[model samples]
Target chain A: MGIHIGVDLGGTNVRAAVVLENGTVERLLQEKTEPEQGAEFTIQKIIHMVENLAEGRTIEGIGIGAPGPLDPHRGVILNPPNLPGWDEVAIVDQIKAHFSVDVQLTNDANVAALAEARYGNGRGFSSVFYITVSTGVGGGLVLDGKVFNGAQGYAGEIGNMILNPNGYHYSNLNKGSLESYASGTAIGKRAYELYGIKGGSEEVFDRLKNGDEQAQRVVDDAIEYLAMGIANLTHILNPEVFVIGGGVMNAGDLVWVPLKERIKKYLYPELVPMMNLKPSALSGDAGVIGASLLTRK
Target chain B: MGIHIGVDLGGTNVRAAVVLENGTVERLLQEKTEPEQGAEFTIQKIIHMVENLAEGRTIEGIGIGAPGPLDPHRGVILNPPNLPGWDEVAIVDQIKAHFSVDVQLTNDANVAALAEARYGNGRGFSSVFYITVSTGVGGGLVLDGKVFNGAQGYAGEIGNMILNPNGYHYSNLNKGSLESYASGTAIGKRAYELYGIKGGSEEVFDRLKNGDEQAQRVVDDAIEYLAMGIANLTHILNPEVFVIGGGVMNAGDLVWVPLKERIKKYLYPELVPMMNLKPSALSGDAGVIGASLLTRK
Candidate 1:
C-alpha cells in the first residue's frame, strides 16, 4: 500500500501528514487556511500542502477533517459557519480530481474519535465516545474501530443536547444545553456576568488556583452540568469508554477530579464502579491522525 | 436447519414460541411464571415449556427475554424486581442442561428492540432506537440489525436519562430523569396529585378525551419531557428511525400528535423535516419473536 495522507483543514490552519500503515505520522506540513479567501483558495492551498507532504510518492488515499454541517456520503460542504464562503464546496471531488486516489471527508470531532479509538486513550476498547469541550461542545462515536456517523452525519452534535429547558440560551443552541453551561465559552461568560472579570476561562482558572471563592463557585457549577451531560450519554449509549479532550479538560485535575466524582451521582449505582472515563491521549494530533485512519476503513 | 425457540419470561407469565427463519411465529404457548416458587422451579418450568414447544424436533437454539439487570454475556439473572428471589440464576446454563442447543439471554427491552428492528416499524433501517414508555420507561438500540447493548449492558437505559436536575423525583431515578417526568406511572401520579384522578395513565387519557383542562396540562407536560428526552437521544445517536411503544402511546392521536409537534421545538431545524418516529407494529408478540432472533447471529 502507498502512503496515507491525513489532512486537518480548519478555519485557521490546514495540516497534512504522511501516515504509515501502523498509524504513525512522519513528514508533515502546516499552512494558513484563510477561509475568508473563499473555498477555492483554501482547496488549492490544501492540495499544495498534500502534494508537498507526499513528495512524489504514490499516494494511497487522503482523508480531510473539517467543521460539520456537511454531507460525508456526498462529500459536500454545506456552509459551516466556521468555513465562510464554503457553500456546498465539493472538497473531496476537488482533491480527487488533482490526484487519482480516494478522498474522504468527515467532521473534525469524528476524525478525532477514530484516531483515539485506534491509537489513543480509547485503544483496546470496542466502543468509544469522544467528546471535545473547547469553544463549543462536540462529539463522535467509534464502534469496533469504525466511526458510527448517524443518518444525517449529525450524530455527535451533543452541544445542542438540551439539559435544562429553562437554562441559558446561547445563540441558536437549545436553552441549558451542555455547551451553554459547561464549555470554555460558557465558563468565561458566567464568570464575567457574575464578577465582571474581563478574562475568559483562563483568567477564571487562574483565580481559582489563587483560592478565589467566586471562581470556585463558577468552576463547580460548570463541572456540575458537564457531569450531567456525561451521565446522560452513559445512560443513552453506554459506550465502552469515553475519551474526552478540549480546552475545558485542559484545566486538568480541577475538571477531571470533580468530573469523575460528579458523574457518579447521575449514573446508576452499579455503573459507577466500572465507569471507564479517560483523558484523550493523542492531544491535538488526533485530528490529523484520525483523518488518516479514516482511509483505512 | 433446526427449529428456533423463543422464551419471554415475565413476572406474571412465561411465553414460548416456535419462530420461522423469517421472524414469523407459527405456534406459541403461555403459562404462569410463578417466579415466587424460586429459581429451580422456574428453570424446570421453562425447560418443560421449551420441550413442549419443540415437540421433540431438532432444536437449533434457544433465546430468553426476561426482566433486567440480567447479564447477557454470562446468561445470568441478577435479581430483577420483576423476578423476585432470583438473586442470581444461571438461566442459560440451567436451560442448556436439558437441551444441547445453544442458549442466549438478554433483557426484555433488548429483545423487543431486536424484534422491532427485524420485523416491525424499524424494519429496513440500518439503525433503530426503540423506546417503551410504560409503567417505567426503558429503551434498546439495534444497530445494523444487531442489538447494540452498551459496554456493561446498560445501553438504552433511557429511563434514567436526566433532563431536569430540578424537575421531579420518582422512586430511585435521578431528579427530573426522563422516567420521572414522562413514564406512564409519572402521568398517573401527576394526575392523582393535581386533580385526584386515580386510575393511572388509562384514567387520565379517558378524562382527556372529554377535554379536561387539568388532564391536558398533565399530558402536555409529560410529553414535553419525553420530547426533550427524544431530542437528547437524537442529538447524541441520530439513528435512522425511532420505534416507540408501551401503554402511554396507546392514547393514539392524543399523545402522538402533540409528541410529534413538541419534539420538533428541541431539534435542529434541518432534522425536524426527517424525524422518522413510528408506532411499534408487532405489539405483544415482539418479545418472543425477538428472542428467537437472538440465535440467528
Candidate 2:
C-alpha cells in the first residue's frame, strides 16, 4: 500500500496529515496559510508543510481540500471568499513541482462529505449531503459512494444556493441563499440587528436559552430558515443523512432540536418518518480524512 | 433486444410509448389521468394506457415517471401536489398485476432527468438537473446516469425549494421556492398582481408580447426569479445542463434571454464561464423517453 498526505487548506490554518489505510492519522502537522503575502508565499508554505509531514517518508501522492469555487480539474483556487488575495492561483502545480507526486484537489465541503460518506456517519448510504454550519454554511454531496461534481465542478456549493429571493444580493446565487439565512454570519447578522449587540455564536446561544425574547425570536427565525433550507435539500437531493458539522454545532441541541423539529414539519411526511439525522463524528478531523481520500484509488 | 414501455404521468395527461433498444419509439398513446376518481382508478387508467401502447408487442418491462412524493422502492404515490387524490396508490403493483412484467417507478422529474442525461440534451454529463417551468416548477436530478432518490425516494422535488426568507408558509418549502416565482401559476399570480388580469400562462405571454408594460414587467420579474432559481441550481448542484422545459419555456427567448443574463450575473463568477445552458430537446417527449429507461439493467 502507498502512503499519502492530506492537506486541509483553510483561511486561518493549513493542516496536513499522513493517513493510514484504516483511516488512522499516522502523523499530523499544522501551519498558517497567511495568504496576505500573496499566492507564492501561500504556495511555499503548503509545499514546506507537505515536505515536513512526509519527512523522508515514502509518500505516494497528496490531496488537498480547499474552500471553493476551485478548479478541481486544474487544481486552482478561483477567488475563494474566505481566502483573501488568492485569485485563480495554481497551487496544484506548485505543490506537484516541489514533491514530484500526483495531487488531487476539491472543495473543502466535498472532501468533508467524501470522508463522512466513505468512512464515517455516511457509510452504507447511497447518497449523502454533508453540510457544515459554521461561520458559513458549506456542503458536499456524495452519490453512490462517490463525490458528485456538478457541471464546471461547482456541484457541492450548496451554501451559495439562494434561500431568499428578496433578501440580499450575493454573487454565487441570486438575492437569496442558504448562507444568507442559515450561516453563522446570517445568525450573527440577525442577532446584531435584533439587539444592537455583537457577539459570537456561543454568546447568542446563551442569550436565546436564557429567554431573551428578542434574541430568542431571532434565533427561532434563523432556525426556521435552517429548517426551510434542510426541507429544500430533503426535497431536491433526498439524501439519507444530512451530516451537519461546523463551529455553531458546538452549541449542541439548542440548534439541533429546533432544526430537527422544523425539518420534520417541512419535509414530506413519508420522508420525515424515514430520515436519519446525525451530527458529524469526525468534527475537525473530517477535513484531513476527506482530503486524504482524494489521493486514494 | 428486449423492448420496454415508457409512461409519463402528467397532471393533465397520461402519455405512453413503446421503446426499442436504439432509443426509438415504436408505438405511442395518450389518455387523461382522472386523478379525481381516486388512487385505484388512476392506477387502472395508467395500466390501460400501458397496455394500449404495448399493443400485444413483447415488452420486457415497464417504467413510470410520475409526480412525487412517491415511494420508488415500494411503488406507491403519496399524494403528489400535481396529481390530486393520488394517495398511497400502488402504481407499480397495479401495472405488474395486469402485465406480469417487471416494473420500476420514479418521480416524473427524476425520470425526465434520466431521459435527458441518457438520450437527450444531457448527453455525456454525469450530473444533470432538469427543471420544468410549467403549471408548477418541477425538477429531476440525474447522478451518474441513474435517478438519485433520497432516503425516502423523495428526491428531486425542486419546486418545493423555497426562494425567500419572509416567503410564504406551506406544508412543504417556504414562499422562496422557485415555484413561487417561476412556475406558470406563480407567473399568473404575479401578473395578476401587476396587471389585475386573471388568466393562465398563455394570457401572460400574450400580454407581454402585445406591449403591455406591466405585463412585460411581470414576465420580466418572473424571468428574473427563474434566472435566480437557475443560478441557485448552478451554484448548488452544478449540473452540466439545466434542461428548461414546461409551459413557461413555450415563450422561448422571451424567457431564456433575460433569464440567462440574470443567471450569469448571479452565479459564482468562476462557474459562470463553464455552464452549458440549453432548453429541453425532448420537451413533451421527456416523460415517455425517461419512463422507457426505467428498468434498464
**Highest TM-score against the true fold, candidate:** 1
By DockQ, who's the top model here?
Answer: 1
The local distance difference test score of model 1 is 0.91
Chain A TM per candidate, in order of listing: 0.98, 0.94
Q: How well is candidate 2 docked (DockQ)?
A: 0.69
Native contacts recovered, each model? 0.78, 0.96
| lDDT string, candidate 2, A35-134, tens digits | 7888798778878877888778777889999987788888888988779878988888888888888898999999999999988888888888888887
Q: In model 1, state the lDDT of residue A39.
A: 92
Categorize the docking of model 1: high
Q: Model 2, which residues run further than 4 Å from truth?
A: A168-176, A209-211, B36-57, B81-83, B168-173
Q: Number of clashes in model 1?
A: 0
Across all models, the iRMS values in order are 0.7, 1.8
Q: Over the stretch B199-244, how does candidate 1's per-residue lDDT look in tens digits?
A: 9988899999999999999999999999999999998989899999
